[model samples]
Target chain A: MKKIINEPGKFVDEMVQGILLAHPGALRTVGDDLRILARADAPVSGKVGIVTGGGSGHLPLFKGYVGPGLCSAVAIGNVFSSPSSQQVFEATKAVDGGAGVLYLYGNYGGDVLNFDLACDLAELEDIETRTVLGRDDVASQPRERADDRRGVAGIFFAYKAAGAAAERGDSLDEVARIAEDVVVNTATMGIGISPTILPTTGKASFDLPDGEMEIGIGIHGEPGIHRGPLETADQIADRLVGAIIDDLSLADGDRVAVLVNGLGATPLEELYVLYRRVDEVLRGRGVEIERTYVGEYATSLEMAGASVSVLRLDDARLELLNAPAQSPFFREVSA
Target chain B: MRTADLNVVARRALADLVGYADELRDLDQALGDGDLGVTISLGAGAVIEALEQLPEDATAAELAKACAKAFANANPSTMAALVAGGLLAGSKTLVDSTEPNQADAARFVRAAGDNIALRGKTQLGDKTILDAIMPAADALEAGSDPVAALDAAVVGAERAVADTKALQSRRGRASWLQERSIGLQDPGATAFLRLLQCWQAALHAAPAERN
Candidate 1:
């Protein structure tokens, strides 16, 4: 294509190099692997080394989550791919202190295979490791088989809680437990208006008829369960929220942190429209909205869709989520 | 084509195909983000690099395996993995000592289609690369010459790409456009056609030098 690039083959390398150049004080590349972004002051002694890995293009999820009180390391794959096992292993070793390391990522097959391999490699290197996979996308799979669910933007909450717990001197085991707990309590559903292209293929991954939207599509543009004429923002919100409500089995008197995330191309106005309805639905159910975040917190490369994540929160979980934390992508309020 | 060295043909095909991706990215940005060039280029480069690591006497099968593994390791994007899956499927054809004499070529088409099905979860008439790919495979299975087969494949892919304008895209970013996707060729279909053109040229020139 007529674009400013030295070579198409080196695009990812160039992008990673540019990120390192721009954020010199905040991030550093782990050797030649652009996927592994580590903190400037890495291997924080006595602090559990928090790590996350996922496909790229959804910036700030795995990488943006890397900073003080968050991930100490992030292994970025190409868009919608998992990082190489070696890259994950290298990141684990780089971020490892005497306190051990926790490998937190999604539950995709490739990611599982590579990260599990990374764990094996890390064990050989004498780095104790724990793994936590986020399966929060209730739209993807049923709650009875939650492990089949895809990890979505709701993972930001997990990172927040796990990061805070690790920052406060929780051991690797404790951090893993916190992440698992967050995963268990979280449920998400997404609606799609448009499908995005994978940069390499220059083709759409899925299709929707004009004036129509698909309910419960997967992040990779896998076919959703159903397609229907486009509905109003409120109607779309009801469908998405209704799925979450049913999947999560929430009843009255429950409290949850809400995150309505835009999938890359959706406008702020539409997101607001969805959020307004989401709030109304939760209120009608007597479900307390303890916290709310509305933005492009996670995305598919320029896909016009949005997902709703509801993290059922308790007093202890609420305290950790609200704990003061700072990162280039997310900021938390102090308890 | 019978006397052609398959490895040399495959390598040239890959290198030339990456150049096509570089060209196709320009076309894609009109309808998609400027990534087809970058993604295909990255995948092809990884395959080329992996080829270098192969044994000097490596068969076409080993070469294909190496390309698949390397591309998976290097890029890990869904597209890369999908392409790698196609290559892996094609590689099995190369290792078959007893084929229907022309099964390698037929196998290539089948493998590519299988990868698309598994990775993208797309089907024919969805205005995808399969539009071009499936027809081309059918023509090749009828024993068309390699170059002619590839040319046919390119033609199929081009027609499929053009037809994408009328059909609602079943996948990718264009899916959101609905009928508004009219007037744009499917970029993936376009890229596939470009690769086939290069593949045709590489195979055509191979037999001439063998004599």
Candidate 2:
């Protein structure tokens, strides 16, 4: 439970306050509640609002993605807990322009419950909204039960694509359709070598021995589908990327975008090592890699692991991916 | 009644509803995490306060939306969220209405019940709040007279609560108890019944009973 902080109870608030102070002109809180953060120039006149929310631990995740060409607003919750429906509604109101709003986030139960309830509140305010869940974690559920899969780092692709559509003033239905299409095309799998200690309880989220690795682990330290002794970086990449590409069913000459993400404790260099193997594997399969991102895009708190996500891309999705995006933790220049 | 009467009656009904919080809490402790009592008490107080601030010219839809926001924000639990969502859904039925009647009450309750059922993913026999809510909705729809409909609602809600004692828990935390939940009173269903009873008493009791 050793970590840097003031009071454990004040961890989320203090961190958020620091972020607001550091990036005053870029991000701002909606209304009086600090839990809801929106782009400074939010409710962008006529663009469809994309509001994403989830727990707090995953930095650069639900919160860091709020900026121009990304999510319009975000409702943050406590570490590993869903935000209240009221918080979600406030974010909805904060980012809702004349065009409708969209709720895009990972597929988690508490999040689903709170956001769905927020939809009702939004309707009462005469604000139309649609929802597209990120269900890209291939290890969480089988293809037959894909809807039941948990969302992981692959949601970044959805955010980028959906945000581009909204930036171009796409209708609410079009934005949601684009987001859902990205979610369906994306596949993610991770391997965990360690676990995280929850800030509130100061307890480990899970237990794993020093030399063992958890295959198909979720960002919240959810148990993986399989566990065994640790393997080399290439071996780990093979397991994760192998599972993802297989799930994606990538064909020869088909194009895909890859994300090699570090789960908290894993270093960037280690991510590159994983990406190198991933590159070889995809190239060997005769699949064309159009775009590659290798870094800490999503992470569990202090968990030692990395995940590989593949988005089977077409020209439209590629163009959307290439569109300009800017956030506190993410940025992309227009092609 | 006009929307003006809606404010006073709703506030009064919620004030009475808070009185049953302890009873609901005790029932929930037997089958759940034992927060239902506080959730109801806090939610009722919040709604009552919110209704107090609404102007005399407030519409029927405004009344329900205010209550929904206040209740949900007061104690942002799963129960609070579902109840607030139900209220918001029910408010849609009154969007065009000013002076709501008995038939309008039925429509609101039915919409609320249906919304809860849809959001909670529970059926009528799930021994949840919806168990009592749906039956009370049916009772409200069956009556033509306002007073009789209120009485019928109380009766229907009570029967649903009683019937829940024979059914295993099937939704929310209570369902985690599995078959062991049988023979115990359901907290959510009982809360709905208590709500109806409170509404009935609010309509019938003297103004001095607001205390």
Candidate 3:
């Protein structure tokens, strides 16, 4: 509690102000609402615009994706809450080009309502709109109807594909289709070792035993499907990859891009350990790993856990996956 | 009947809360993340700043609107959003009115409870802030006088906080404790209850009636 802060209420505002101050050229806020985080040169013309939004605590998911060749705009909600319709509408207006706009985000209910509202507003403004929801978390719901699953780190893949499609001058409908395809091919599963603290309540979102983990935990502290004794790095990875593979119906000889993502408090060393095991599992299954991304692509602030996302890749998808993407949270390396 | 009329109460509650915020968070550091103090302080600060700029002669509900706006704009964290959700729920009960009656107050309390349930998915006995908040609301609704109602709420909340030690942490960080959390009162439940007690005492002693 000795941390330096002006006042608890001012933390987000001050933090938002500080972020803007630190990167004046990189971001701009819409009016008094801090939720709408947009690119500096927003409202690009002739090219389709991409926008994403979600709760605030997951730093890089919604806001961090707003940049060149990524999301043109992002509407940030409070931790675990969806941004208001007005915030989404403002972001839509800001990012709308002569070409239509695409509303790409998770399948959370509040987000669905607000983004739907934004789409209505955009239509009124003569800006065409398409939406692609990312629901790749197999842990949340069953795979027979995976659209009900929550979107986790796998959303980063959809963002990349959609952003690249928009950059390539594809229409908004084409971009939305490309993003939806990625979502369909993607599957994710997470394990939680610890819980996140809710800043306002100053309490943990959930609890775990010293030597146990909850498998299939949601980022917003939703109860996981099961809890069990602590397992080694390889064991945990095996469980996660096994669930994802089964959920996605990946057959032998399938190819994919792998993302081993940490849930905030998990260290790179541990993530790499899981990554190694996952690599082994996929290789053992004869699944070719076209690309591998390891690190905190998305997070549940300070929660100790990790998630695995695999997107079954075809040639076209692989090309888009290999395309260059630069954001505060992502970097691409040329092969 | 204007929002400005409630500024005195808002400022006093907020200032009083700054101390409570720091204290609550400090206590939470023992078992929680220690954000309660700072987040509440930040929320109060937002309201205080908003109050200073609001037009004079506003009503209690108007003042409440400003508070809600400040919360919506400033504190977007999950915890803040939960608090804001409950407050907004309460405010919605009186949005059309300039003042509050016992029925309106009761409606506000119920709305707050519902909002918290929807936002946090917490139930009583989960050793969450609801352990204190729900009973407090029920007591307030049943009390004869507003001050007495709030006082009853304070007592119910205090008792609930004490009983939390026996209950398991079902929702947040305390849940991580698993079974070890049995002996410790949830830091969030305690701080929130304590703040309410303080608010009741101050409201009982205030010179103006918030008319």
Candidate 4:
């Protein structure tokens, strides 16, 4: 309701404009309609294109991941809405380097439908396309129906692995297989301490009383599995890490990458506090931390919450995760 | 009714949709992201604007195609995409008809509902828009007069909207709420009901002889 914007209707467009302006050297708008964001040097000849897309409210996600070692392009949509199939096709066309393209994205229904439609369109143009859906949010569905789970911050791991593989000139099937493997090995759980207001409606998507926390809520403020009084940072970390570890069946001496992602409004200091607990919990369980990302990697629009994602890592995944990548939002130092 | 009349009816339905946008937003806020109202209105506005550029004598299929493109382009939300897919599918049923009658209207509604179900992968009891749209399509199929059929469809949709309060969502964002989504009207279903009511009202407001 109270935020910085010229017009609620133009929020997504203006945001895209700002992002392009801020990252002029790294990103550019593509497509006939200019609805897609691609890496400045997209269409890398012979390299398999990696593309992802979703609704707009989540920052540093579909768009922010478009770069040298991340997604080659992203089809952008309105806030909390999927991009049109035409837009997706444009992104596919913009990134296709003749080998093929892989569509990596969350498992939301809208994204699924639009991306599937785009694949069909791309087929008409003789461009091969494969899809790998990210379903790593443990809270959306039970483990038995893991395919139905929503993709949260855990998708960041998939992006890294797939992007690195593609950047190394891996074939589309190989890149997609690697991405799917990452999706299967990753699990994420989030806790919402407060609700966010939709910009257009200027109303809270949902209500959370002053002193309550909802564990397992999605980025859109969907109701979580459990709602109760707010707990301490350690307790919150225990619940999130405990759920993810249980779902993943992580054993002692296992190696994993941890990402403590802030949901837009949470402060970095608070995220680090949560990450500290996550580190302590993993250490106590004998799980080796291969790498750690504690920051606002993916975000909802000003939602006060955080999510913890753990990627069970093997040597190949670790190698890819450590590969050099640079985007405006995500960066991995060359090792 | 004449094929030209379809454009007028679509315009009226869009106006009603734009008018009820805020109400739909409030309903969605209870169970899902509160963007349905704006998304639907934006889609409708695009359709209406596109309709303005169409020839006065355009066939029902052409009109429906324009609406399909407009809705899909203006709003890419799940609900909007489903609606756009439905319109595209329904247009196929009217392709051969120069002036579709009540029977064609019935078939259009049924085809639209079936396409939405297929495209969205949702069924009657999924607590989605299909809950209202499927029943309304059936009701429309049972009647011969356009006005009466629309009236029947509206009643059926209204009942389905109320019925959704007792059902749990199994599709789209509302499904995330699980049991908590119970007792809240499915926003997509409510919007479908409003659309039917708007169409019925448009049918009634027109001259009776043409219908």
Candidate number with greatest TM-score: 2
lDDT tens digits, residue span B1-211, model 4? 7767777777887787788899999999988899998888998899989988888788888788788778766866656657776877788899766698887877887898887777678789999988998888888789767677778888888999999999999987789999999999988989989888787777668466323
- Off-target runs (Cα >4 Å) in candidate 3 are A1-6, A333-335, B1-211
| Candidates by lDDT, descending order | 2, 4, 3, 1
lDDT tens string, model 3, B103-174?
676777778777677656678888877788888879878999776787788889889999988887777666
CA displacement after TM-score superposition, residue A301 of candidate 1 (Å): 0.5
DockQ of candidates 1 onward, in order? Answer: 0.03, 0.48, 0.03, 0.09
Q: Interface RMSD (Å) of model 1?
A: 8.0
TM-score of every candidate's chain A = 0.95, 0.99, 0.96, 0.99
Query: Sorted on TM-score, highest at the top, how do the candidates line up?
Result: 2, 4, 3, 1
Best by lDDT: 2
Worst 10 residues of 4 chain A by lDDT: A117-126
State the lDDT at A317 in candidate 2. Answer: 99
Question: What tens-digit string does per-residue lDDT give for candidate 1 at A1-335?
Answer: 23355754566567678877777788777886777888777889888898788887676677778888788899887878888777887798888878899988878877876676566446545589999998998877777788887888888888989988988999999999999999988888888899877666666877777888888876677667788888899988998899888877878999999999998889998999999999999989999999999998778877788889999999989988888877667777575
- Please report, in order, the local distance difference test score of every candidate based on alpha carbons: 0.77, 0.90, 0.78, 0.87
Which one wins by TM-score: 3 or 4? 4
Model 3 lDDT tens row, A144-248: 778788888899999988888887788877898999999999998899998888666778888787999999988776778899998999999899999888987
Comparing 2 with 3 on TM-score, the higher-scoring candidate is 2
Query: What is the Å distance of residue A5 in model 3 from its true position?
Result: 5.3
- Model 4 root mean square deviation, Cα atoms: 8.8
